[model samples]
Target: MKKILMVATNVDQIGDQQTGLWLSEFVEPATEWTHAGFEVTGASIKGGKIPIDPNSYSNELPRVWDGVMEPIHDTAKLTDINPDDYDAIFFCGGHGAMLDFPNNNEISALLDHFKQNEKLIGAICHGPAAFVGNKDVNDSSIVKGIKITGYSNEEEQGTGLAEAVPFLLEDELKEAGASYESGGPEAEHVVVDQNFITGQNPQSTHRIAEIFKEHLS
Candidate 1:
């Protein structure tokens, strides 16, 4: 089975909006990958446990919650996870991710591993914020010349967190030299660049996972 690594934020606050990995983004996508028979591992900056945003999983989206089929392992064990051991790495998103993941060395190292080993790297929503600090082993921009997209600045403003959230996802990706594109601030947008696929928001979760499986399987 293909092995996959999932990285999420352990922080569960969003200036009182209640945040972490959006359930649909993490669960729906991982479910599709796991059911396809891949081995999935969950990691957070803190390791062992990660927080789930209560608002992300509502009765409005039952399939996503039900689809999440397994327990997540400690991410700190990822120090031993070679990119060669996993088919791809997925960074799930939520508003809280913007607060916790950007400056994390662990996340940056994982991205570096994928780049060096030529493995897939996937992310959704503000999860792309984790990419803000990932540099290629050679010290050049890693996502340079790479087509990508994530939660747009407009969406951030839409959420009324342009100031509350510390950084801007689209602006940071552009600053990093990624060839960014999106569904134009829409909720269900997804972008794929070879082994790197990104979902625009929680609504884009399942489709993003399907895109990942289609390539890996």
Candidate 2:
């Protein structure tokens, strides 16, 4: 069986408002992976309970909230996990990801390890924030020249958090040299380039998991 490390932000608030893991982004993919018999481990920057962005809660939660919340509620610290243990690593998104995913040396190092080993890597929505400053062995941004997609500036503006987020995800990825693409606002779009797979938003969650499984196979 393949193993996957799913990383979520511990940031429970963005300024005075609440923000954390986008519940559907994490839960939907996790449920799919679990049902497929993948061993999925959740980790956070600080470990412990990973907060969910209240705005992401939906009626669908009650149907899939059981087994999915365990790993999330008590995630391992990112520093404690060995990147070598998993076949792939997925960064879960939320507004909180913009606050903590970038500039995180631990995440950068783990991404480096996975890239060096030719292992799979994935992220969705604001989760691509983790790739902002991450670089390859050549010291070039890991996303440089790759086709990737994430939460769009339009979508951020729609949320009225264009200024609240640390940086616009689509813009940051482009700045890193990625050829950013999107399926417009809230449309499902998943980009698969080599070992890196990125989804555009929460709407792309299920498809991201499907593509990841395809690549794993």
Candidate 3:
């Protein structure tokens, strides 16, 4: 079986502001990939713990899913892993990632390494922001010319977290030189750019995972 690494944030808290990641992000994609016969290993920056937004995990969503759980309610934290061994790297988002993941030198380095090796990279919602930091060995933005999308500015504003998230995702992505474009104002759309797959919001999880599975195959 091909090995795939699943990366989710240890981020459990939403901004003093709003909730994100929504159970759909983890559950649908995880379940889909697991069902697709890929060997998936879930990991976070800190080993042993992972965090899910309390709000998103609630079963009110029409397609509510809750797949990504440790044997515990809390998420797990993983110290390090070999991105090289994995055929693809996936980042699951939550509001917490906006706070913890952006500055993780290790994640940035891993993304750069995976991107350099031309390995497939996956990021959803705020998770995609993590990849926004990757720079090529030449220092040029690796995603500068690529079409991509993530949590959009309008989505942030709608959630009243425009100020809570470190930076506006759509704006920041464009700043990083990505040819950023989102599906619609809603977070339910998915965008795939070759080796890089992105989900606009939690609702996009299922499609994103399906596309990832197709690409991995």
TM-score of each: 0.90, 0.96, 0.86
Please, what are the lDDT tens digits per residue for candidate 2 over residues 60-122? 667665888789989999889988789999999999999889877898889888988989999
What is the per-residue lDDT of model 1 for residues 1-217, given as tens digits with 9 covering 90 to 100? 8888887777778775767767667777777887899988877766666677776655476654463534443454445656667778988888878887776666777788887777889999988888886676686666888899899988888888788787788999999899988787666777877668888877788788888898888
Evaluate residue 22 in candidate 1 and report its C-alpha lDDT on the 0 to 100 scale.
Answer: 75
Which model, 2 or 3, shows the larger TM-score?
Answer: 2
lDDT against the true structure, each candidate: 0.78, 0.90, 0.72
Cα lDDT of model 3 by residue, 59-118, tens digit? 564442344344224433544576777888888787777766664667777777778787
Q: Tell me each candidate's RMSD, in Å, in order.
A: 2.2, 1.2, 2.9
Query: Whole-model lDDT, candidate 1?
Result: 0.78
Q: Name the regions of candidate 3 deviating beyond 4 angstroms.
A: 14-21, 59-68, 71-79
Off by over 4 Å in 1: 59-69, 73-77
Best by TM-score: 2
The alpha-carbon deviation from the true structure for residue 87 of candidate 1, after best TM-score superposition, in angstroms, is 1.3
